[model samples]
Target: MKLFAVIGDPIVHSKSPRMHNNALQVLMKNAVYTRYHLKDNAKLKEIVNFFNGVNITIPFKEEAFKIADFKDKSVVDIGCANTLLNKNNKIYAYNTDYLGFLKAIDNFCNIKNALILGAGGTARALAFALKIKNIQVTISNRSSNRLKHLSDYECCLYSNLNLHKKFDLVINTTSAGLHDTDLPCNEIILKNIFSNARYAFDVIYGKNTPFLNLAKKYNLKTKDGLDMLLWQGVFAFELFLDCKKTKEIFKAMEIALKLP
Candidate 1:
């Protein structure tokens, strides 16, 4: 069986193995997916020496981006990699975060105004994904200094979430809600945002987040990162299959990972 894994510093909580293994079983593919925790990002190269390829996650996405011999422009824009492919003798990296993010918002008809809650690599991918659709995206983060590279866009402090303007979409890209708790931001801010927001998205998926709960309380359409997680796996599986029985494979994955 071909070997694959998701690599990161803190990977114990990842459901990627369950998701991917389900997909493999549904598609009858000969593959094994696992998770590996690395103390250092530099160990990625050494790990790649054995495995065929691996998915990347937080804290290491940028490091994986740096080491990839070739990078898709989409991954370059995100400054990270969520999917890595070992092609020929070169390691290539791509970011399916946008693919998953795009799939999350594909059903939302109008998304002209949106609020993004972090300034990390996933946030960058989401911002560009929004920009691609010609939507205006405003980002709020703790320290606006590290976001100098994103200065060209409208950016502000997280405290300014109470501004009078109403957003059509609000996405929580921070790790804040992963532990089943909301960010330190006031509850009133979420009430204010989701009151007018049409949809909400949180990138943390192991469970329904406090952020999503607050959005749902306002009757706003909300989605966790789970579908994005599943679809990205579908996207990567297509690459892994190299066009062999693509539709059959994806349909099976979709059924196996069907969302409630």
Candidate 2:
């Protein structure tokens, strides 16, 4: 059987195995999906050699892109990758996160300006996605150092968020609210940022995160990362099978996620 897995730190909470395994069963593909709890990117080379294809999460997307022999345009643009395929003894990288984010926010609102909270791989993907849609993007992080890599976009320290400038959309790409009640930015900063925002999106799924909750309190349309996860997983599955039957595979994965 061909082997597939998602590699990340603190991966015990990931639902990717269940999501991909169900699609494999429905398609009758001879493959098994699993998880690898890697604490750091140092072991990435060794792990990539062991799996035929892999999905990257959290801190490893940038590392994955660095190690791949080839990268798709999306991965090249974002400087990060979330999907990889091993072919002819070479690893190829792709960034399905961009596609997923685009699909998740489609037709949601007319967002002319967006604020992305965080400067990680996911943030890069989102920034690129928004830029292609002609949406002005401003990225904010706790420190200014991480923002340097994403110099293409307007960036600022969390302490210097442009309160006077109104943002139509605000997105939290950090993991701050994934395991705790912490908000990505200070509550005061968030309050000011959301004052003129029309919608908020948090890239942490399954639970109502504090970021989303705060947006809700402000009467802003809020969305968790569930749809982004589903769509990204679907796109990754297409790469794994190299097939076009995405509609059926998407349905099977959706059912798997909904089941107890």
Candidate 3:
């Protein structure tokens, strides 16, 4: 069987395996999907070469991009990758996260400006996507040091988020709400920002994270990462099978995620 897996540090909670495995069953593809809780970046290339295809998450996307033999234009533009395919012992990288984020936020609201709360690989993907849509983007991270990497966009420290002036959407691209009951920024900061925001999105799924909860308290439309995960897995599955008939596979994966 062709092997595939998603690699990340805190990967135990990932639904990529279940989502892709179900899609494989629907497509009758001879493939298996699993998760690798990878803690060390040094082992990424070794683990990826062992698999036919792999999905990357969190801190490893940039590392994956750096080691790939080839990268899709989107991956190159974003400087990160979330999907990799091994062909003839060479690795090719792609950024399904951009496509997935676009699909997830479709028709949600008229976003004139967006505040992205992180400075990691995912943030890069999101910033790129939002800019493509012509939505003004501002990035905020806990520290100012990482802001330098995102020089194209206006960036600031978490404590200085109010300097942005205005925002229509607020996105939590950090892992602060994952595996813990913590907000990405201080409660007062979030409250001030959400007071005028129309929507809030958290890249951490599978639970009502404190970030989303705070958005709810402010009466903002809230979204989790579940839809993004499903769509990105669908795009990755298409790459894995080299097929385009994704309607059935998409339905199957959606049903699998809804199972009790």
Candidate 4:
């Protein structure tokens, strides 16, 4: 059988296997999906060659781009990648995070400005993607180091954030609440931002995080990462199978998400 997996440092919680395996089953493709708790970047570069396709996640997305023999233009521009394909012993990289993110928030047509939390590769991909759509982007990371990478856009240290500022969209690209109850920033700050924000998005799925809870308190439209994860998996499915995400596969994957 053809093999596929998503590799990340903290990958035990990933639902990619459940989602992708269901799609493959519905399509009757001879492939299986799994998750890998990656501990080494050098190891990833070597192992991806043995798989038909690979999905990458946090902390490794940028490193994945660096080692790929080929990459999509978006990956080159953003300096990150979340999908990889092995064809004829060569590795190709692509970014489905931005595509999935945009699709997840497609209903909001008037997003003029956005505030992104975190400064990892996912943040970089999202910041650049938003700029291309003519949306103003502001990125905030607690530290100054990662914030420097997106110098072209407005960058702010978490302590320097203006509570009164209003943004149409606020996104959490960090893993702050993924395994815990920590908010990305000060709770009062998030509450202030959410009050003036029209929509809120947190990249952590499977539970209602403290970040989303605060957004709800302000009556803002909020979403967890489920939609983004699902659609990105769909895009990766297309790449893996070398075919379109038919209506059947899409619905099948959606149904799988509701199962245990």
Candidate 5:
């Protein structure tokens, strides 16, 4: 049997094990998937040697990229990675989050400008995904610390958001409501931006977060990160299989993600 898991802080809410194990059963892959609460990102390098692969989340994606011995261009381009594969005692990194985000918003129309709220790894992946589409992106974070690595985009602190400016898409990339009732930003700020936005998206899945619910009140087309998780998991699963691509795998994973 092989071992695989997702690593992150506050990982109790993750549905990834349920999402992956079902698909593994369908594929008859002799592997088990689970979650690990990694309070310290630096511990990742010391741990992954035992697992066949691991999916990274939250504050660790950038660190994942930095620690990998080998990297795919996606990770190289974004300086972030959500998937890691171990082979021949070497670690390889990839950024399926960018691909996942692209597939999630594939149907969204006329998205020329986007406002991303957060400055972490997931936010970094999303900004890169939107950049390739030639779309304008403005990243707003509570602090300017992590925003420096994302200098390629128009960056600002939450206090400096142009209250009157509009965007075709507004995304909540913060972990604000993932485990609590808190919204990603001030209610007034969300209202000002969401009111002028055509779409609202939250990176938190499995719940109707205050951010999404508030966007609903404004009649903005909204989506959570469930689809993003499914797609990224699928891509990571493929990498786990060493690229033994098949449509059956996608179907199996899709069915698994729909479970409650």
Candidate 6:
């Protein structure tokens, strides 16, 4: 069977196997998807040698970008790599977060101005993607300290949102709302933000996060992380699957994700 996996430190929480393997089975493809809890970057070379392809997360995204023998310039510009494919003994990197992210937004209405929460690697790629589309980005977080190291784009704080300034889109790239106790923002501010947003996108796919639920309550179009996850996984799988088997793999993924 062809093999694939997603790598991260806290990989145990990943549902990628269920998602990807299900897709493979639905498409009648012979493949297995698993998760790897990599201890550190020291074993990156070994890891790459073993897997035909891998989905990277968090800390390893940057490392993947460095070790990749080939990469999309947009991903390179962001200094991160979430998807890696090994072909001809060379590593190829790409950033599906932006593409997947944009796709998730397509599920909603138009997005012109956006407010992104967080300033991490994914945030950087997302911001650049937005820039390419010529959309104005208003970044928000608890602190602006990290902004000094990132872009000089307009930055705001969750506590200081202009009650009058409305945005076309709101995205949550932060780890907030990942756990049961996590919420995207304070109740009052979240209400105000969603009141004006046409759509909301939360990068967390595990469940219906507070960020998404709140948007729903406000009657704004909202999407979970699943579509983004599926699109990115499908894109990453293409790096490994041949022309004939490619179609089957993604077909299977659709079935898996839609399964009850």
Instruction: Name the top lDDT candidate.
Output: 2
**Alpha-carbon lDDT of model 4:** 0.88
lDDT for position 142 in model 3: 92
Instruction: State the lDDT of candidate 3 residue by residue for 27-112, as single tens digits.
Output: 88898999998899988999999999999997799999999999999898899999999999899999999888888899677899
What is each predicted model's overall lDDT from 0 to 1? 0.80, 0.92, 0.90, 0.88, 0.87, 0.79
TM-score of each prediction: 0.90, 0.98, 0.96, 0.96, 0.95, 0.86
**Which lDDT tens digits does candidate 6 get at residues 1-260?**
87888999888877778777776666666878889889889887689779888899876888888899998997777778898888899988888788777666665555678888887878877887787878888888788776665664787777777756788888888888878667767878878878888888888885888788888999988777877787777777665564445457556776776766
Writing each residue's lDDT as its tens digit, candidate 1 over 93-172 gives: 98878887898778988789899988888888889889888999998888877478786479888786656788999998
| Candidate 1 off by > 4 Å | 244-247, 254-260
Pick the winner on TM-score between candidates 1 and 5.
5
Error of 6 at 61 (Å): 1.5
Error of 1 at 24 (Å): 2.7
**Cα lDDT for residue 189, candidate 2:** 92
Considering every candidate listed, which one attains the maximal TM-score?
Answer: 2
- Collision pairs in model 5: none
Superposed Cα RMSD, model 6: 2.6
How far is 84's C-alpha from truth in model 2 (Å)? 0.9
Please identify model 2 stretches exceeding 4 Å from their true place.
none
Candidate 1 has an lDDT of 0.80
Cα deviation of 245, candidate 6, in Å: 7.1
The CA lDDT at 156 in model 2 is 95
lDDT of 5: 0.87
What count of clashes does model 1 give? Answer: 0
User: Candidate 4 on 114-218: residue-level lDDT in tens?
Assistant: 999998988988887798899999999899998877877899998888889889999999888765678998987887788899998888888898888888888
Give candidate 4's error at residue 91 in angstroms: 1.1
Write down the lDDT that model 6 would get.
0.79
Candidate 4, after superposition: displacement of residue 223 in Å? 0.6
Backbone clash pairs for candidate 6 read 23-252, 23-253, 27-252
